[model samples]
Target chain A: MSDYNGQAGDGMNWQPGLRESYIFDRNTIEEIRRAASQGIYDIRGFGAKRKLPHFDDLLFLGASMSRYPLEGYRERCDTSVTLGTRFAKKPIELKIPITIAGMSFGALSGQAKEALGRGATMAGTSTTTGDGGMTEEERGHSEILVYQVLPSRYGMNPDDLRRADAIEVVVGQGAKPGGGGMLLGQKISDRVAEMRNLPKGIDQRSACRHPDWTGPDDLEIKIEEIREITDWEKPIYIKIGASRPYYDTQLAVKAGADVIVLDGMQGGTAATQDVFIEHVGLPTLACIREAVEALQEMGMHREVQLIVSGGIRNGADVAKALALGADAVSIGVAAMIALGDNDPAYADDYAKIGSAAGFYDDWHEGKDPAGISTQDPELSKRLDPELGGRRLNNYLRTMTLETQTLARAAGKSDVHNLEPEDLVALTIEAAAMARVPLAGTDWIPGRSKDGF
Target chain B: MTTATDVEVVDLATTPLRELNQRLHDGAAGGPLRWRIVNPNGAHAVAVGVDAPFEIEIEGHTGYYTAGMNKHAHVRVNGNVGVGCGENIMSGTIHITGNASQACAATGRGGLVIVEGDAAARCGISMKGVEIVVKGSIGHMSAFMAQSGALVVCGDAGDSLGDSIYETHIYVRGSVEGLGADCIEKELKEFHREELGRLLTAAGADAKVDEFKRYGSARRLYNFNIDHAGEY
Candidate 1:
């Protein structure tokens, strides 16, 4: 076979330009270019994008000469959040604003979900259940668990609903807005099947929509049902895809939701079509502003808490989301990375799976090299839950620290106090959406008379 | 005239439902308290978290989320019910003598719910372990994403019936508009017949055993193959 560069691997006889002209210094770039030339778009596996204006785009607008900074060790900064107060008589008071988003048992093993709960508990935050119903291990480990009620209704139960700290009625996910969940048959182990109440070996198709009501009017009733089931004790959250966010957020609030979770296109999933992930929903940055505007317009900004997810990777991303008007941020892909996904040491096994290092994202397959996303016994054995939980905890702590550092630099004592004025964007689209100045200039195209 | 405590009738009209619930919780009333709830008109979350083993009777049309999260309580609605009636119910019984709106018994874990009239879409969706018996026809996407449980329909079922159903068993006597992806018609074995019979008895329906058809998963798309890469 020819070399990847389309050149023969002759011993000591190869000449320059025998394959092709190379402009980039890194081999990864070359591989990307080669793949792109063949109609394959280089997809994001895990890492910050080079082209986009991420959380680092804005600087902390520190306290001015007139303002005084608090002593690092002496002063206190609170990061707590209360969700679902509108309907529930008693709402959940989270220790931290940062919470773990829902990740299902079918997409990941029971061990992974357990680890997530454990890590979030250690970090003084909350964990969530995904499309699948509540598992004993997940509910037991999480300090404050948010049970998700998706279109699929897998694993849903009254016992779990009563037991949950909060309920999230998921209208749509970011990865595939109008699509259903597809847990390929191979990944459906006996335990998973039992939990989901499906056959042992069958491709599970989660419904794209609820069977009962079709519109917002019906949603109000759905919310009511959940509150009644929980005896109005637990809060209820409404989660929606980023598409048509302004209207969706408004509808969610009108439907009696106490908390609204807006997920953008960058959200990762266990299984979704490549076409849908890349082309379906709006970006998180844009969605946050729209959601915030909707809440602010209704005079229910802080009253109806907004939790934003999709593509948030680090402390900077969390800070940026907060600054963009989000009450808190949820991270899914980053959490998996912290659990040892995309580790270079697993290159050999990745190759065995017909994929090389940095090119493995078929999470639907049970033969995952990273133990976080597989049901296969061999793959799952490669991971140690204790170790994984520790790593995730460490990562969460680091992210919190980074967020605090940014908050302090911006002259704010609390992470939630960071505002949009504290940041600027490098790109025109980002600047317009975030309502900030363009990098290295005072121009704001939408706000200013002279467009940038 | 009957004395206030003569029939042990809980009047939801004059009394706040929460206070009545407290009264029930405190053991002030027992032995199937006859609840005469007047003007139940569209009140969201009317009868939630009722754990007492008593019977409740809603007089008129109830709004969204009626009889939600019920545990060991038998609730009866005299008129039509709104969305998500008896959702996430754990045990006991809920009987709608009239038509039921959307999402009847959605994600219910246990207990038996019987709808005398037509049920809207998403009936018994994501039911963890509940048994639902509908006497009339059901709307689109009924029982979509059901996990484990039993749903018996004496009338026709709407579109995308039993989509992504897990261990849940469905028996329909009437025609099915469509089957959801991966869901297929299965043979009505003896065990299934017995299960349907039990559900019918619970729902107080006199439907015949052979009248209903069974449905389940086809068991394809379990493992990934390079050839099937584009299917998703």
Candidate 2:
């Protein structure tokens, strides 16, 4: 094998043992070198700096000597949650406090959506449609389906609405608020375009805001319209991004929304400007507290269900979200991971795409290596639906089990009963937002006057 | 004229919209009834999926998303309509006798929508395969990011008209204050003139086709070259 350091030189004396000048950390230098070599203006569409507090900073404040712990296997730990009781004629009763958030068929493939529905059904949860209308395959596969009514109003059908288990009125997504949904032209296959009723191979723009309503008052009428259409049978969920969550949540409740789904900045999207994803919205942790506070102020806590999403990765994240006053937690990126997002087996293909194992995020190009987020025929085919579904089921089960473990440790019999008192924050920001005590201290900021 | 046996009138104020829609979905009861929706009362999603080739007439101002996802049926709204009128219609004719709110005929696959009055922002946005003829002015961001199909505005178009358009044809008789990203004015050729004339006649607009200006995509933003990728 030829040595990489061996250089062929004519009449040149070089020393291979001498080291160069040392400066910054080698890892940091490597990052800068890679970035400079790529000459990319700023990595777009992939992971970037998000303002929200990550899962690492938050810790669970498990029950102490004062509380009783439940038996791991013998005691009943109910994870079931009910959503949209304030306005819905029939609230949603979920087997677990985990539901699949809205991911459009236009953004993803029909097979992927079917797999999501299948997995969610197997997990005894609900699946939601995004900007695109309800597909027969997805609806048929999903035991409980939440139809989204977006600003674009693509594929929205009364028949589907009547057939749906619930409806989610999409005001905005976490990735980009007041920003339209984008499915780049390359991924806009004929079928996807047809489903959205747009032209083939064109970047589809879903409207950022509702057309008629300029404020909360008009939203009331809009909500009434949806209720009138569905005959008040299905729950109406109003989803908002984590921008001004306190006010938005209150407005959503005032608008007669049955359920409120709050998404934070870390939420995933099919296509969004990297700038907007990183710079626009608040973190999921901050948003959940504001939403919960708003509901509590109105005495609607647990009466109007609150679902939190964005950056939820594991069972610990789900349990923490519930403890932060969320009735349930929705997962998008984590679900995509379960569908094989960053698997190491596709290293060669990733290299071919000018990326490596942990650096591949070309979701907009439809050339995804892991087969979870791509419209390319070959790439999509790499994902076997059965296997993908099984994997998702396994991941979901593991998360449920982990949540049960945490619940038992917290001396809580029901997962929904997990309250804000069961969590603590390692940072001042998290403590203030989640209304929990600082790590290693029994003092909470607002609850105890002398704590600060 | 079709007989009364072929017509079914439902009062939306009292009758639950779901039951009415269910009846319509189950197929026309007691013959093919031209559903005369009385007392719409700002109700939304009226006659949304009439796939049986029937005709429905709404006599009042309707709320958000009226006649959404229409399929194989003709729907006529006698008064102004709220947001997303005729949204994602597959194949049908939606005639708005009065003004339509924002995103009129948004993402419709195949349909003929004639709006007699002004349409609010984002009119005909992401049009897809629909043909929209607006006799009056449209609001800001009209036709913003339209993917395909034809939008004929007899009156002036608002700011940012046809932003990021792709393969879609926009014909405006009056001034367009602004053009959206990747959208540029195109020469009004003979074919476009004919198309404009046809749309004008269909919409019952008396405006001369020669007066209209056509706009389309510049086609500069399709490929993701390193030079232009950061602009977004």
Candidate 3:
């Protein structure tokens, strides 16, 4: 026994339970084993788990010597953002720059969707309907709601289109840019099945491409059709995953979109193959500059609003995105967490389902202990929409307050005024990706800019 | 235009199409039911959002989404129509005397569409509970991913007919260029023949039900099978 547990650096000693390099880590080994045993890849929810260069690698260059900083409490730091002013008769006006990202009624419980709408309305921001289309509960709760026109067009109708404050034409998603949407059999409730016009207890995969149109040229005609239907009252938004952001953005602008939503790899999905979620699309940090460059080249940077999403957690991430030239930022996973999606209170239930409290990602299974993702009546009963709404409102308020604090520290009267000049990256990768200068120096790496 | 009786004339040249649609929508369930639209020269979204059971006649060619989101209205297009004719309809019928562009009767929930001439690509795509009859040939990928509907094509079908279809009954009279992934020819039994015959009769098409072949989903790709992942 003593020999089996030999100490490190001991000569001629047999080591027990030794592991391979971190490159072939435990999670990787587990995934491979699971795939091999099941004869299928793992499907899960949430964003990319692997670490990448994120907003944490960049820091605000707070006002000093030559710059002037506003007093924290006394000075006002406005955080308002307006979306879709380019073509729509009524552009959405928000009290904060952070909006709620689209999360479908099927992917989430009805209570959760209603709570999100309530919270967003309370925060004076907007919420969006996901692939499954608009629910009456969400519509009643949300003051300003953007309806998504996905490839599937599940539950889509002209009445709902006209009822929407804005319309988002979802060309692709961040988790799987080229991939279609998947709602497992377990998640398809009777109501959801009826809404989507699919059979109950069958795994539904949405179309990867639009049924009518093929390319961007055809897409322009489709957009015109939508505009004609809505009488140009609603702002038409084009959302694309962060693959070929520059080209996609330019195409979206040329298609006469009032807004563009660029989602990065870090964005959450309800259910998708782990491979697609991890391997597809660019990181949020790397995609923003290219998207902004497209808008700048077209001379429509601020004219056609750009909303950045994927991996937005807190005020710092929002400020960083806005600083990188995003008109607004949208959040999904963070909002779910705020609504008690992975609460530790359900740790015992989570363990029963073969997942831990914080690591639970089986959203497609419809066995969510926290009541946010599950369609099961007993499980959904666990969440109180009013309480969840309050929690989300609190979270939104905190993010807004923190953003204002940071803007004041940077001497920006408005949150949108915090530009790339006030930011520096701690790493070369981040510097190159964010197109900002390196800290303690003046080098942007890729291009020759004034900062260098 | 001369012999038609008991009709309300709406000239697109004089009144805006939106205003006409608004008036049509404002009328109650059993109000004035016959309307004749004149001079609709390739205009888009003409006579949209009609909920009542009105009988509307478009005299000439129209652009995209002619008579879209129609409910209970009997809309007749005398000439060729562009993309998405009678899209997302709820009830009633739409008859096109001439050809229809891509995605005719797309995502329609109820009602019937009769294309007297050829229909282009993706006709009846994602159609739900609607019945469409095409007298002439259908282009590529017709009825692609149709959820619940019946598309009866009197003539030949182009490539990849009923690709990724879902529960929709397709009856093609002539040859099919190819079958799409997971879409295959199904046994045309007596019940299917009767269904096709009824649909044809409703659309006033002069095609025999026995001459057509049926196509549907094989149900192989319904679930997330690892073997099928590559095809997707």
**Best lDDT goes to which candidate?**
3
Give lDDT tens digits, candidate 1, residues A1-452.
Answer: 23222334343545776553334323445666866675543332332222343455555555668656655554676567777767688788876678898998878887788889888988888889998788887888888899998877777766788789999998988876887777878888999888776668777767787755678888886776666556578889998988999999999999999999998877878877665776677777778888999999999998999999888878888888998888888888888888888788899988998786666787787777988788887788777777787888999888887777777776678889888877778778887777777877787667887644
Interface RMSD of each: 4.2, 3.9, 2.0
Candidates, ranked, lDDT: 3, 2, 1
Per-residue lDDT for B1-232 in model 2, tens only? 4475566788888897777776766664445557788888877777765666778889899877787767777889999998888877778799999999988887776779999999989898877778999999998887766767899988899899887676789999888988887889999998888888888888789899888889998977664445665543
In model 2, what is the error at residue A84, expressed in angstroms?
3.1
TM-score between candidate 1 and the true structure: 0.84
True contacts kept of 3: 0.46
For model 3, how big is the CA root-mean-square deviation? 4.4
Model 1: reference contacts kept, as a fraction: 0.66
Candidate with more favorable, higher lDDT: 1 or 2: 2
Stretch of 10 with least lDDT, candidate 3 chain A: A1-10
DockQ of each: 0.43, 0.34, 0.52
True contacts kept of each: 0.66, 0.32, 0.46
Q: Give the TM-score of candidate 2.
A: 0.85
Query: Where does candidate 2 chain A have its weakest 10-residue lDDT segment?
Result: A1-10
lDDT of 3 by residue, A107-178 (tens): 999999999999999999999999887999899999999999988889888889989999999999999999
